[model samples]
Target: MITISNLKKIYNNVLVVNVPQLEIAKGESVGLVGNNGAGKTTLFRMILDLIRPESGEVISNGEAVAGHENWKNYTASYLDEGFLIDYLTPEEYFYFIGGLHQQTQAHVDDFLSTLTDFFNGEILKKGKYIRDLSKGNQSKVGIASCLLQKPELLMLDEPFANIDPSTQIRLKNMLKSMNKQHGVTTLISSHDLSHITDVCDRILLMEKGRIIKDIATSSSTLAELEDYFAVGQSATLLPQIDEEENH
Candidate 1:
């Protein structure tokens, strides 16, 4: 449902994102793994039109992102806490997002109800503005609102961050159900390899603004992925440090 061609973004003479091509078909869940400055968020922002790419284009279902009037209808994205309206209550936030897609409050409520297991009762009943809630609760509201629209393409960055471990498992199950039940195309990015391995069908690794690895979960084990991902490469080198100290 999404395609990117020759996408490039540069800042201060440094290239941040430079994908030559990418395509995500319907009902596929892809995980993006990368270091802090690996340009995952930059790529996502360009796709969402939050930032204009210096060159190339983002297309969804044959429609260019820059001029697609129906883009919002097909795509729902949450990149950071800033996307949530600080003043809006959880109920108001869900309604607002659902209304953007021409959905009614009932639609939003129904969606939220299905996710009660994921929410753990912290979503709509909180007595204060979203900003007043804890970070984890705020994340629940943001993710719940994103799912309320039943979007075809859902782009979530660091969805597992700040969420508790138990709720993280709930979210993983929720995402799996969403893909299997609704055939939603999802693109998620995170530093947590475990979350990506458990939830995503395919994992794409990025380094220095380029895709370094893209592997299907069925084809590889997490330990092999850890070797590929170099999750604790620096830590593993500590033995070498010990040798040097002895020398």
Candidate 2:
């Protein structure tokens, strides 16, 4: 559903993202894993057109994302708390987003009703603005808002960083269901290896603004990722490990 070509983003002459080509098919769940400064978020921003790429273009459904509005209709993303309107209450923000999608208040309410366990009874009717909530709660609000849009393509950045363990499990289940049953294409970047492996069918390992490894999730994928991260500069060792595992 998305295609990128010759993508490059630089800051002050330092290349931050240098993806030459990448493609995501419809209904695929892809996970991005990397340490700090891997340019995952920069790649996401370029895909969302929130920032213009220095060299290339992001294509969504055959149209350039850089100067197009059509993709916004089916794409929903929550990168951080910055995506939320801090001054607005969670309910108000959700309703506003619902209105933008032409969903009635009743529809939104029904949709939120399914998230009672996911919210853990802390999100709705809290009577506090989004900013007043703790970071975890704020993350919940942002994620809920994205689900409210019923997007075809969903992108989330570090969704497990905040939130309690219970909520993380719930979110993972929700993502899996969205992809398996509802066919929502998902792109999630997370530092949590176990969670990402459980939720995504494919994993992209990025380093130094480049995609160093793109592996289809397998029984040994988690161990491979762990080894790669454990031995920071030994990325060249992954292929040997993979071959050994296969044999």
Candidate 3:
């Protein structure tokens, strides 16, 4: 559903993203695993045309993404709370997103009912604006609103961040079900190896600004990534076990 070629992004003379060519097929769940400065978000912004690439182009279903509006008709993305209107309640936000795709309020309500497990009862009818919710709750709202669109292509950056372990599992299951039931193509970028390996059909390991590893998710993908990251190659890997998070 997506093709990229000669894509490049530079910030302050440092090339942040420079992919020569990449393609993601329809109905494929792909995961991008890399530490900070790996160019995941930069690549995403370029794909969405939120940032102009230094060179080359992204093609979404045969249409160039940089100057086209039609690809967005089938795409929905959530990178952070920036995608959400903080002033709106969860219900209002979901409705607004759904309405953009011509979905009715009744349709959004029915769809949200299916996401109760993912929400864990904190998202709806709480009478709280989205800005007032906890960070994790805000993530839930963003993700749920994305799914409500029934998008053909979905991109989520760090979906696992700030979410509790239990909700994380629920989200993994929900993503899996979405792929199986609706054939939604998914792209998830994360530092969490376990969850990404468990959920994605394929994993792309990125470093600096290039894709270094592209492997099909398999029986040993987790162990292989762990072993690859265990070498403490300061040039390649981030230090494991961030101390600040523990405190």
Candidate 4:
């Protein structure tokens, strides 16, 4: 459903994202895993066309994403609280989004009704603007808004970070159902290894602005990721300490 070629983003003369090529098929659930500064968000922004890449292009359904509006019709993304309309109450914001997608208020209400457990009784009818909610609640609002769109391609960054554990579990089930049953193509970036492994069918491990590993999820995917990050932490620290000693 998405293709990227020669994509690159640079900041402060440092290349933050450098994907030579990547492709995501329809109805596939892909997980992006990386530590901070690995350029996962940058890559996502380029794919979403929120930021222009320094080189190359992203293509959705055979059309170049840059300078194109058609992809937005089928794509829904929530990277952070920045995606929210902070001044609006959750209900208002949801209704506004629903209007954009030609969904009636009744449709939105019915959709939200399915999320009672996911919301854990904390999101709706709170009578507070989105800005007043805690970060976790704000995240819930953003995610629910994305789901309201019933998007063909869904991308969420660090979606598992803020909410409580039960909500996280609910979200995983929702995403899995979307991918398997509803055929919603998903790209999720998360630091939580176990949850991502459970939700995604394929995992892409990124480091230093490039995709280093792309593995199809299997029984041992979580263990493999754990080992990589565990050893990776030590390897990174040892290099810095060695450099300091040499200095």
Specify the highest-TM-score model's number.
2
Candidate 4: Cα lDDT at 215: 81
Local accuracy by lDDT, each model: 0.84, 0.94, 0.89, 0.92
Rank the candidate models, highest TM-score first.
2, 4, 3, 1
Q: What TM-score number comes out for model 3?
A: 0.92
Residue-by-residue lDDT tens digits, candidate 2, 141-194:
999999999999999999998899999999999999999999999999999999
| Model 4 Cα RMSD, 1 decimal | 5.3
Clashing pairs in 3: none
Task: List TM-scores for all candidates, in order.
Answer: 0.89, 0.95, 0.92, 0.93
Candidate 2 wrongly placed segments (more than 4 Å): 234-247
Give candidate 2's TM-score.
Answer: 0.95
Task: Write down the worst ten-residue block by lDDT for model 4.
Answer: 233-242
Clashes of each: 0, 0, 0, 0
Tell me how candidate 3 scores on lDDT: 0.89
Off by over 4 Å in 4: 233-247
lDDT of candidate 3 at residue 93, scale 0 to 100: 94
lDDT of candidate 4 at residue 207, scale 0 to 100 = 90
Query: How many residue-pair clashes does candidate 3 contain?
Result: 0
Q: Give the 10-residue window scoring lowest on summed lDDT in candidate 2.
A: 233-242
